[model samples]
Target: MSEHAKLPQDLDPDRPSGARIYDFFLGGSSNFTSDRMLARRVLAVAPDMRRNAVANRACLHRVVRMCLAAGVRQFLDIGCGIPTIGTPHEVAQRLDPSARVVYVDNEPVAVTHGELVLAGNPNAAIVRADLRDTEEVLTADATRRLLDFDRPVAVLMFAVLHHISDRDDPAGTLRSYLAALAPGSFLALTHLTADHAPEAMRAVTELLLDSQHPGTPRSKAYLESLLDGLELLEPGVVPIAEWRPEHGDADLATAAPLGYAAVARKP
Candidate 1:
């Protein structure tokens, strides 16, 4: 397991965090031993996890570019994990310096490292909050400062919703955020599913049940329901790897069974 030179005081190194485990799957060094341990267990059951992470991240990048191409300059990336290469802000700001982004994550390590990575970039900021709490996230100082609800904004929820349990009412939480967005705004999301490799994914989910972030991989129909009342984009909801893939992304098809992704406008 990789070790960071310094970690947040409030971070519990013994507890495995979903965000940190994702970072580990991305081959990033922002994870603790506990996180890596859990990730390894998951990989043993679902060897495609690393590839799935890559595909999910690629989907996020494409979503950002698509939103930018559609003239949406502001972004709210809720449940944004540890900041890494090809983040929404990096992609958006590179294309349009005026583009603004707000990243929200409940993990202390993610928030701390995000703050450090975003430090001098006036166009971007990170907020520490639970995504289920729409009000807190929407009203946070950083979110309000960087994003204007009156204008078109891209709300990103890549590899996030599955982490929210049914008890928290993930769909209701999503609706609250969607209701806040303007008509021209966009919602791009990716969620894990057990459609293709049910047994493997179910085992993975069981292992994560005791972690800091338990997950509930849903069905494609259920994920599609989350986009109700919005204008679904072309190609409709499909495997993450098939969502407007770019050159050299053909290999992503191998991981397509892992998750579902889609982008829609509020209309």
Candidate 2:
């Protein structure tokens, strides 16, 4: 494992973080040298990392749009990284002025950035919390202030699950969150998987595991099991690029590695 230096609340100039590495991949400047170094090393193994990030981000946008169409005005985005341009709150509020959103991230930098981005928006707030602790996440002051559990809520976990290693019991964590939602609520997720590109994807996973954010990628079967009790929407557990893509893909034969997106409803 890499020995990383600690970073302050405002900036972690020495240590590498998953959120910052992701930001670097997305061409954002919020990351430090350590993060960029790891990002580059992982990219050497998986050249499609950039494409994977973009496809998952697009899926996030599409899911949010679908939520708006479905008349969901309350959103709880867990494991949301440093807020960049066109975040969930920005998109949801544009769709409905009354829309409320709460962003949660374990990284202090992520929470700080989210707070700044959401400043002056009474309907939105940010909290620093771990996704593994579903109880605290759902019942936190920020969640209570911005979301009403009595009403339908759209919970988003886009491209964040892969970071939750197998030992963490990702399924159990998801179940706790799902159990807390009201009927008619929704669960939208985009996770990294190696089922499609085993060799290359595994190399990336191993690299990340040795880096600051330790994690493991799951197979399609494991991912499907995570949605056991919920009713999956159309195109269940497919490539993110294939999930209601604004522009349909002419070729759906080859599967995209390092990404899978799906949205389910709790009945």
Candidate 3:
């Protein structure tokens, strides 16, 4: 069957989505032709796009493990694209069967695929909503059913904030979400940046300007400012691959310049 046939009827297979594009970058089969086409364009200028995606994903795995080790059992993965291998729920549930996860995303394809992937799993559910809509997401039936704001929850936002424009107030959106969580909750974030390769990143940014999800790569200084209230964890806001790599994974070090990552506590 064709990729379009596999997608939900309500989705436009021709329209490129950032979630699908990132899924393609991670070598997943959930993306459409349009998503691959846009990804190829990005790869042409930013040859390290796929590597950076993998690095960012690895960072997420480390964060989940750290959170679980810290005694956190609930996870709110905002803008969690199509569920792929080693996803928060899968990683957490593997370590602790009772761990609850609520995946949130506004993309129809992502939500549809997430539902299918999470089927029969009572401990996990997918919520379709924009991350910027703090109240809506926090109050969503699935979110409330699976996560308890009175207890600590890990808010995962990997490779999603760049799509949030400045006018939308990314910092404020984060604050609002963090405000809903109880103290001691964690925020694990990984964002694209132009600090390492300005010209190449600028070219990629221009290519995506007209796409469905235009990206805005910020500098380390600016991304750091977003975590003002939260107490940033050790090795603050370093490259995605550099954040507590398991066994000192030397290969990921090269991709470090592509993005910044950090896990902070809502103290």
Candidate 4:
């Protein structure tokens, strides 16, 4: 058996996991057959799903680069899925060798993969903790070592919040995380939305909810509400394709159906 196959009981392959599914969407090999099946279903509704994923990931890279340019050296990436090419640490460390990053995720396999990716990398670490349990993660040993809340830090939530059902109080959950950060800290968030293609999106959303990690699309109004106290950065609250897109508008116009992406700074 492969090393990942010999993984412990907590990394259950029977039920679909958000991390594995996302990895499949990225065309990574660190996923089970179940994850690929779900990815196919998701693609059926949004044919350009892979493009959408790439676009969102590009947004993440840009945001990280911008934050680093602003002198932010610490990073807290919540809901961080399975590590892939050009992870936040990889990008940030290149900019500032002293940069520190703490990755938080609720999935055991994701945490394992993240750790494996960061192995022997003294500047980064991953903490396997529930995203909703803000207090635990904030107080966890990993956080203590990798992040210093006294100074400015960048908190990234990419394509992960959608997994949090409204019933889970995602806004409240975000507030707690924001509350932990110091002033001048940055908040980078990108969420899945059905506002563009509601009919097809509804079917895909239902399939996800019924499978394992369920989610609901946040309307523009709802997404704006999440930015209540934070100071939104330039070109505020635009489509994922419009957020500092490297490619021209024509490419983005036909790329894929995606969510809204925003980056804000706490004053």
Candidate 5:
């Protein structure tokens, strides 16, 4: 709603975008004042927004490495925000040179920046599309060009599903993406939740609800329900900070708003 900032020609600086806000939180320079202001407001509500963002980002890296370690090199990253440090392509390709990734986002700024960062990387590309439109996302020219449907793919939807409203049928969206993957494919997700967080997070959630990135925090049970048909990995769905935390949570805010993280495999 804060629209008093400068944006790129293809972007509306006045309108706050989730990707830009996320970029701001990630310590990146791809966001505008409107995004920073909104991010700061959420920070006021949940003082640990930075820690929560770090935990969510850590989950993304872990999931990518986890899938790659399992020999799944191709990734279909839906709702991929603005490219930042340690992005999927960066992590995946560093571990395995042949790792292929198809990043998808609805924001023009994110897609534009993502393409710029990924330019000349034959194994990675970005597609601008809504995550809710599974058919279009799965069948896009870029997606088909960079990935093979018959092989196992790691479909990543990190910290984005909460932005999808009930009317969007988030559960069906998960199913649609899963149905498009091969038998050995995987679904990894990390979504915001108020289940184990402080009451202040509810205010933050409501604030975001009124913004361009309207999000609804689901319960732990509901978060797991999205992966009902798939086989969940060990540790199940837990707080993002606790999901295979490679480094000790020395500085992690234990009281940060919980963001549920989990990965399931298709049978």
Candidate 6:
């Protein structure tokens, strides 16, 4: 058996992986039973987030399409999960065949799966690197080769930044990327927040601390602070479902928004 096959199947097939759990939530088959167990517990508290996951993905697609429409064709998807569907490349390339994408994820499984999925797509590539290490990720061979630093690129991080702990200075790490982007580049992100969620969501956050990864849900104000250097776009920092919802999507104004989503330009 392969080394990967020999491992036990937990949240990540061996441990709880945010990417794997996200994949499971997105209706992908790449997750393990442990991931489902945790997901069930979390979902039970805030049922909106399950729908939020779907919305978050759609939000990502819209963000990519928006960037494409704005004449920005290069992309950098940080903390990109195991590409199950509606990926940055998939969304961007579908609209403009010349679109280029560089997906970065610290998870091995996510990178491996991304590579396999993009095997024949010359305009796209994946890098196994931490998002916090902006220099390493942006300077990697694939990134240097596929993306042009001089052009306006869209950096996307959907439903992933909450996984970064405050101690690691998630805000500070973000500044590095913002500084690296060329003029008029964009930064789009969605982050989980306990402020507007059910009280029980806090317990779920604690539960994650004991898992293989540590994540802390921030407040709307805190999440907004992360955008200090960027200029907010229209309908700034609203709930995931409320961010330019596609036609036919249910009205999210009355629903309990599980996380916040927004896009900004580095002017």
How are the candidates ranked when ordered by lDDT, highest leading?
Answer: 1, 3, 5, 4, 2, 6
Tell me model 6's lDDT, rounded to 2 decimals. Answer: 0.81
Best-fitting candidate, scored by TM-score: 1
Indicate the TM-score of model 6. Answer: 0.93
Task: Please state the error at residue 29 of candidate 5 in Å.
Answer: 1.2
Predictions: Cα RMSD each: 1.2, 3.5, 1.4, 1.9, 2.4, 2.7
Of candidates 6 and 3, the better by lDDT: 3
Across residues 16-108, which tens digit of lDDT does each residue of candidate 1 receive?
999999999998988888898899999999998888899999989989999999999999999999988999899999999999999999999
Error of 3 at 108 (Å): 1.4
Clashes of each: 0, 0, 0, 0, 1, 0
Task: List the candidates' TM-scores in order.
Answer: 0.97, 0.92, 0.96, 0.94, 0.94, 0.93
Question: Over the stretch 137-173, how does candidate 2's per-residue lDDT look in tens digits?
Answer: 8889988887899889999998888888778988889
Best by lDDT: 1
lDDT by residue for model 3 (192-228), tens: 8999999889998998875678999998899889998
Per-residue lDDT of candidate 5, residues 1-267 (tens digit): 134434446777767788888888888888777788889998888877778888788888888999988999999988999888899999999998899999999898888888889999999999999989888998899999999999999999998999999999999888888888899999999888888775866888777764578878888899777888889998899888878778654356466556888899999
What lDDT does the true structure give each of the candidates?
0.90, 0.82, 0.89, 0.84, 0.85, 0.81
Candidate 4 global CA lDDT score: 0.84
RMSD of candidate 6 to true structure, Å? 2.7
Q: Where is model 1 poorest over a 10-residue stretch in terms of lDDT?
A: 1-10
TM-score of 5: 0.94
Clashes of 2: 0
Selected candidate, larger lDDT, 4 vs 5: 5
How do all the candidates rank in terms of TM-score, highest first?
A: 1, 3, 4, 5, 6, 2
Candidate 6 local Cα displacement, residue 6, angstroms? 8.0
The regions of model 1 sitting more than 4 angstroms off are 1-4
**Between 2 and 5, whose TM-score is larger?**
5
User: Which clashing pairs does model 6 show?
Assistant: none
